[model samples]
Target: MNGKKFVESHFHKYLTEHLNAEIALNTIQNFDIAMNWIRSTFFYVRAVRNPSSKYELQPRMDKDLIDRKIEEMCLRQIKELQKNGLVILNGMNLQTTVYGKLMSKYYLSFETMKLFRQIKGSETYLETINTIVKCKEFSDFVIRANEKGILNQLNGSPIRFPIRGRIRSNEDKISCLIQAVFGNLTLPTPALIQESIKIIRIGDRLSKCLLEYLRLRQSNDSKFRCYKALLNALTIVKCFHAKLWENSEFASKQIRKIGAVHSSLLVNAGKTTIKSISETDARTIESILNLSAPFGNELLLNIMITYPTYLLDISLKSENVIQVHLKQLNEEYIYIGSHTVLIVGDSLNNLLLYEENV
Candidate 1:
């Protein structure tokens, strides 16, 4: 037999068995309503198969009529079942303990048949039902949580810091930079260890400088100016390091690997630049400029160190250059005025030696 004929034969057989003398004579009308309801649901599902398509399921009088009839039939059946002590309805809703088990069994039997047909056609009815059940469970959990409880759970959680740009000294800044560069890939364990080593070395030096400045018997204004400069320099260094790391080929590769595993990471990276740029302290701007001028020159050189061909491109041009020695690195440092910017290869010893000279 053809598919449509087979479906009709089975549907008729089901109605014949269910519509017995024990059921009300009106049950024939209920059976028709139930069949129509199933057909309408199937039609709706087919309409939504290609969500991107312009096609839509329009409301029809036939569908509405069938739905109303089904509701009425179910209500009547519930009433009859309750009267016979086969089920119970408290107020409007059916009591699950009395009617739920039987209703579920009926639903399962019908659904299993529907699923078999769906599977024969290479569809996923069972999977869809399981997904719906999972979604419902999650929704219930979310709805039961109180706002205060949710807030409490989130209060101590770490905020995501957007790492961007370069900086001279902050550990947090360096960490952010490292994350930006290597965050997306399975970085060599040794690379991470090396980065930590660099951070600790830089952090120790910065701490020492800050401590000495703090212990000095300078006037309040002088001390405040020194403190401000130190803090600003640190913040800038951190930002710079984070950006440098993000732009590194190693970091980019890592990010690509991460993107392969988590689709959202690539999307987020494209959408944002630096994660965060701490506001420079207004009071420390001058001090920061003074303390950071030398380091900034060094950083600018470091940026172009890997690309030596870009060195001549960084030299400052113009009328007056008799006094200042312009060790042309890249246009990266030209805006910083007369400060000596030293570009060195990837050698920590060289970097340390240059800093000592400054």
Candidate 2:
């Protein structure tokens, strides 16, 4: 028989026989209700698979999507339960409520049966189950058992299947299971190894701060200290050139270009010419000139020693005698104010430096 037909037949027979029988062991009335709900759910899913529907446009049929659908159905059931005053929402999602949980368990059992059959012949089934068990998350044992049963059945229902020996302790059992499954798996490639190492290094640094904060109970003072520490670390790391700047050609070119401009301008200005002005006045004028220039020329060095970068604008504005108009390359006024300086074609860093000097 075709795969789809086989699956449909098995699903129908299983629902009518095994599932109904299990439900009947509970209250007969609830058995009927649950059976009807399960049947309806199966039909709804089958209908969704029809190419004529909009639901078919959705992505793949994964476990997460199935879980979500089951949750939605459970929520509807829970709402009915709540209306009858048998249950409460309690600010929880469907999966967290009593009625919702019952429905989820039933749905999970059915879904696991389907998945077991689907994965039966796959070479990775045992490996996949081993990984799930090792993770030890919710429903791991149930999933593994179902897979094992299906695999055993597929292998001709052998009277004496090979029994893997269990270890004496739980920790040993988990370790042995992992080793048995993955010991033969090949090591990662060099590129993957390098990436993993980088991730581990970053994680380790973050983990140290995390542990310290956790141990201190993250009090207000502790939090503030952590924040300050992070800022200081960022400053130190940002200043480090070993990993990024590292004698780069770009850095060398920028230094050479700026140094050449500084030498040419300082040479033309002549040492004797600057000697007449008082040192302080010379420094102040140089700062003002840097604020007015497009580049961090000799003017910037003088400004750095004479005036703080923040006071530049205030000092310039106080000079009411000079009306400064900042203009663009086309001589169009971009800004007009007292002591405003026009800088043409300045890089963002150079502009920032000028702003600081001002």
Candidate 3:
């Protein structure tokens, strides 16, 4: 609208038509080259015209045209990924590098991964959030004409981290939605609710991606200062899973079933985290939150097992360098920072920093 020609809603509408199409469509994007997803897409688009015969070839089975489109999509995607260092030409064959492998293995888009590569492990907390909200994953988080006022009202309320400036941009909405998830803020609309849920679902994954990128950066650069940024990333991951800001006064909500309303009750009753709940008798918590007997312990158990534990190993690769690894350990629990949430199965969520000043 502002001289960009197609407003964001235009692109979002097109994406919705492709992704949520009722019939075969060739206008979708990002072909999965090795999986032959492109071939299937092309074949499906062509076959939609002749659905009467399942096995019979279509009236216009232009194999050459389909082949050409597939080839072009493959080369175009691979070139973009390669240009951004996600893909590499190893000898005569094009293959995924470690970065590329992680991105693929984690279901990350190359567009988001490319944005993630810009982080230098020296960003402020706000800077990290700013960069992440702009990733391709949040590109679909469009700001409607009406919702701006709602978002503006929420920004004025006691949000955990009050953002500067007016409420605008898809990134701004995403930024607000993420905080709403963390703060368990009461959203007024289903759209806001669904958006919060989507962001929550991907929050942990994004954290993993960030940590993976940090690990890679630490490995290659001996002088990288990773302690603060790593710790902040870890806290962000914890906040995502815990569904509460790191510095929120209502920390008791981290306990399962103790939502925003009852969270304050627990705090007033001197029960904050699971550790606090563990210390108190079940009857005490029940009396505090007005739940029936034994429900408190049940809630505690849910909190304990609500999220799966990942084991993360942070070992020193050298005097000034640290390598992060997702190892299968007998012990329990870990944490990130990334576009796709550099996640590992029972991995991420740990960091150890060592420096040689003398």
Candidate 4:
């Protein structure tokens, strides 16, 4: 057969009819490349035709044709992922947000894809994929724990705790305690004092109880849920505190003046929440999309290192730079600013700047 005819025949007669019959038949939107490869590879390897096998393959199974088909299938799947703003690579689904930092990238390896196809039928394979996608480290922890027989007696029962009661008074009590301790002590920056207060707050007896519960949780499956809930609550507290510190007026005018010296400091750090971008800034963002980006702690560190004179804002900062001097908390907040550009990240280093418009 000629090249065009060969490609067309495989696509229509084999690919659509054999590999993707269910998808083509139902018009399903959520496409998973690994799952599709698993089903298709199984169909190709079978010796006997099942009731579902509607078409007979050409007697001579050309390996090159099969390889090309798989490649095209992967490309189509990747296109779908791209459209959804997700990335999948090397049998792994890369996280969009890791430990509270944002990253948008995907990767997939040929060998890993082939291995997934081979093992897709295993009972644990799907579970393993689900676990990894949710949190690879957590999945690995569970797997290791299981191998050690830690889960042998697990009934998957829920664990309950009075979380609401514990958290309700945590903020006020912690704040009062902070005020009592550091309220008397003078500090250069109120931000630093606030951070100190947070550190102290985390060390409180109640917080210690939560940490202890998490530690003891490893021995008992019944406590896992409670432990996780407590851990999540504590994390939220930390994030909230960090955000407050980021947005707080500098402890003194001297601090603010010092911060203003930083080349690209994000003044009014968390005041403006960025959801959508204008066409102008969107264009600039597109150019930097491929540039290495930092997430979570790394992003925080980048902000600190690049803008040594400034605070790390919890929210995403605006790209626009304002030349006018900013007033204290009571003053009008302005979003207009020049794009302050700087290198960010220790590993995946990239130029950091704000988007202006499309």
Residue-wise lDDT of candidate 4 within 1-358, one digit each (tens)? 6555311122323332222223322332234543445345544444122212232434344655554554565456544433333333333332221200111111222222222222221223223222122321111111222121211211111211111222223232233223323222233446435644554543332233332333233223332233233333344333233322222333211211222222112223321211111112423332333223332234333323332232233333465432322223312333232122221211222112212121
Model 1 per-residue lDDT tens digits across residues 217-313? 1232231223333333333333233333223322222221122333233233341221110122322322433344444344333334422222222
Model 2 stretches with alpha carbons more than 4 Å out: 1-224, 236-358
Q: Which one wins on lDDT? A: 3
RMSD of candidate 1 to the truth, in angstroms, is 28.1
Q: In the order shown, what is each candidate's alpha-carbon RMSD?
A: 28.1, 24.3, 10.6, 22.5
Write candidate 3's Cα lDDT for 4-48 as tens digits.
542112221122122222112222233332325434554445443
Model 1 stretches with alpha carbons more than 4 Å out = 1-192, 195-198, 201-228, 236-264, 267-269, 273-358
Each candidate: what lDDT?
0.32, 0.31, 0.61, 0.29
List, in order, the clash count of every candidate structure: 22, 2, 16, 21
Candidate 2: the clashing residue pairs are 309-356, 312-358
TM-scores of the candidates in the order shown: 0.17, 0.17, 0.65, 0.20
Cα error, residue 94 of model 1, in Å, equals 88
**Model 1: lDDT of residue 139:** 23
Can you rank all candidates by TM-score, best first? 3, 4, 2, 1
